[model samples]
Target chain A: MAFDAFQKRKERQLLWLLLPALVPLLILTIYPALYAVYLSMTNEALTGVAAAKPRFVGAANYLRLFSDGRFWNSLFVTFVFVVGSAIIGQFVLGFISAMALRRKIVGAPVFGAAILLPNAAPEVVAGFMWISMLAGGDHATLSKILVFFGLPYVDWLQTFPLFMVVMVNTWRGIGTAMILLTAGLAAVPAEVYEAARMDGANPRQMFMRITLPLMAPTIFLYMLISTVSTISVFGLVYALTRGGPGNKTEVISVYIYNQSFAAFQIGYGAAGAVVALVVSLALGIAYVRSLKVEV
Target chain B: MAGISEKRSGAYTLLAYVTLIVISIFCVLPFVWMALASIDSNVQLFLKWPDSVTFDHYTKVFAEENGVRWFANSLFTVLSATFIVMVVAGLGGYALSRSKAWWKQPFLYAILLIRVLPSTALLVPLYKILLTANNGIGTVLRPLVGEHYRFVMQLFGFIDGYLGLIIVLATGQLPLALWIMKVFFDGVPKDYEEAAILDGATLVQRIRRVLIPLALPGLAAAGLFAFMSAWGDFLLPLILLSSPELQTLPIGLFRAFLRVNEIDYGLLAALATIYLIPAVIAFSFARRFLVQTFSGGVKG
Candidate 1:
């Protein structure tokens, strides 16, 4: 009876302890999310009459969203951004960096530090830095480099806004992918490689047969985390392009921001937000179920 | 492993070095330009060797602009948010690690799911909620303080105030910090707490005396991450603070860039360099904890 009483008391204490975190989350994250759904169904505006008296329009905003070409363009841009940066660019470059670092090479730490530096850069700084690197017609860094090699200067951002955005996003994330994949690489036992070598397997064959299969779980985790994060990337792309040169670089987050604030269409933006939220939540659920996380 | 030919191995090692050098250059090139531009007297958009290295641009940021205010604002809000995250996550994480209640598992899953919900999606409604709270607080404060209303509201109001930004930033970071501290506390044996309890120590006493000392590393990890993330945040400050007095470094740098007619490359780079320093310092310190946190995040 006493033990039961002690256990009960402890739990009550814990509930009190949890209240500080719980309250803000309830008001800010949970409430706002639910409110987003409610707000999406209404003809809400940031200012003017709709702000004063929001009216429920049911599926009207969503119908409008389904037909919107810019909305479709943003989705396509986001898909390309996630896949191009997180899946392809960062992964390949990071994996190569990781692999090279494992070879008992000289100056490995310097290489590692140099690569990780970009991850530490704030999005705004990274965007501003890239503008200097890309925007200065004849005086841009890339143009200067091209001139040194006697090649024509290409107006990078204006000519290929989406690609430049992807590359910059890729640059920011390569460090994260490298660090995670490095941990994954370390976990694959040296004994496996030794056994493969005994069978006269080349490095390529050994990696395909041994490393790739062994690192599947880590790779999957990296993919899920990176994809979700890359989708959420805003300040970098926003500061870089502002979804412009004709909305060519508009990812979903920027799209939502532009629709809501720039266009003053809160209800319309919320509908797009709902779509993003659902997509992310679905992926998150899959991640949880797949990992069957220990917590 | 010795079954491999030595000649082939040499080539591969050389290839590895070449790859590393190239990738490292690609990664660090932009930063190099930013640094050089900050010091270059004749700085332009492109990378170039300085004809005469100068400190004038950096001084211009402080003497001519609001560099000090921007830096202080960024530091103050981010630090306050980090502190709140540490304290809240510390207590809540202990509860999570030790408790076997039914709510534990559901709560855990909810926070993990919360991690994936992008902040942009919630911005509109979040704005609405803050607006309502701001009005409520304004109503309550306007009559009480009379003439000092605006000043007090700037400090305490929910919409364009210090308190609102600090609380919201901390909350956005809570899920990860909670996970971090929970995982950390799980590894900590409960014997010290048990002993403290047997000595008739109250919960608060036990936490202050026993748990805090043991949870320092966990707290450091949580705090570092919270600081880095909150420091780097742009959207929250952008939407939250409209007043020039409240501008953070990111906004200040952004605004400096937005002066289309009078663009000063040197000063902008200096501002960026100043902004970049703290993040780099924090990141370097946080480096050792990265592998553990990322793997712990998923494995937990």
Candidate 2:
């Protein structure tokens, strides 16, 4: 009877210990998530200082988003951005770098560390730096260098906004992918590579037959994560162009921010946020499921 | 046969060097240009590098009276926030790993949701909350923070200082830190904990001895991540700190870049490069640990 009473008291104490941790999560994370969903359905001007109150509007905000031209453009740009940077940039660059540097190339480790520098830097700083570099004017050295080499100074932001964002983001993101790929590559035991080499397999054959297969799970993980990261590419866009050269580089997050803060169209912005949520949810679920299947 | 193999290997090695060298150049070009631009005067930025060499911008960035304050604010916020996260995440993760408490899975999933949720969704609400707090109940939390010995408000010798910034960043980063530490702790088998328990060891002893020491590499990696994210974050500091004196490097760099009437590209680049240094050094040192952190997250 005494032991049962002691166990009950212990359980109560554990619950008390948990409440403090749980309360913060409830306040910050959970409440915000539910409130975001709620805001998505309301016709509110969310400019924080506005006198307007949020009113019920059902799915009108969402419906309007579907018909918006800029919304569609932003969505398309997001797809392009993710594919161009995360899928092709990180995946391809990372895999190739890992394969090429798999053996002892002189200064390989140093090279590996150097490649990660872009990602290590503050992203806003990177965005500003890239803008200064590519924004060819009297001071744009890259353009000048290209001109010296007899190549045309392409308008990176004006004529090629999405492309510029892609390159910059890709440059910034390659570090994470490279590091992940390196880990994945290191995990594949040397015996497999040695055995393949003993059978007169070339480097290409070894990478294709043994290395690629072993690295599939890692690649999938990297792809999903990189995709998510790419989708959330806002700081670069926000800093560099402010989604401009005429909204050419406006991504979903930027659009959402502008709507909510700049235009005071909180409801419209919340709807955009919902769309982002849905897209991310779909991608995240798919990634989680893929990871599970591989496991 | 040995000669043929040797030749082939040599050829392969040469090809690898070529590929790696190209990639490394591509990777470092933007950074190199950024560093160069910081030193170049406005006129020389358009000119060739041989003609464009000056430290005028670096001097400008440092000479700005507010620059020191901004750096101190950023360093203080990032360090304190990171410290809070390490403490909370370390303890919470251990509990999550060891105890199948009533709300464990639900709590974990909620954190996961927050971790994946777009920052856009939270920004407005968080802003409103901060505004409300600033206006309404700021006094209420002040005394509590005082009692807990944060004493940050008094120590910094500035009003509306690092304490507020630390709390927000720490809270924002909590989920990921907790998630990482949970994964790290989970990787340690239950038998070790059971053995400690069997040996009449207290819960703290088990955590201090078995769990923390085993998870050091993962903890280092996670701590590094928190540090980098906190240091580099732009939006939070931009929105939260209205005072010019409390701006972080990213925010300071951004404001410098965005100034109207004669944009200081040289100064902007210099500041950006300055802001980039810590992240570069920290991540490069912890590169291997970062790789493992990713793989471990994937596995989890």
TM-score of chain B of each: 0.97, 0.79
TM-score, each model?
Answer: 0.98, 0.87
Instruction: Give lDDT tens digits, candidate 1, residues A1-295.
Output: 9999989998999999998988998999999999999989999998899988999999999999999999999999999999999999999999999988999898889999999999999999999999989997878888888999999998999998999999998899888889999999999999999999888899999889998999999899889888887888899999998998998999999999999988889999999999999998998888778768787
lDDT of 2 by residue, B255-275 (tens): 777676868777777777777
lDDT of 2 at A154: 74
Measured on C-alpha atoms, candidate 1 has an lDDT of 0.92
Worst 10 residues of 2 chain A by lDDT: A286-295
Best prediction by lDDT: 1
Tens digit of per-residue lDDT, candidate 2, span A135-212: 766347567778888887876678788888888887877767777887889899999989988888987788789989
Candidate 2 error regions (>4 Å):
A1-21, A47-50, A194-201, A293-295, B1-8, B40-43, B46-56, B138-164, B187-219, B296-300
Off by over 4 Å in 1: B1-4, B296-300
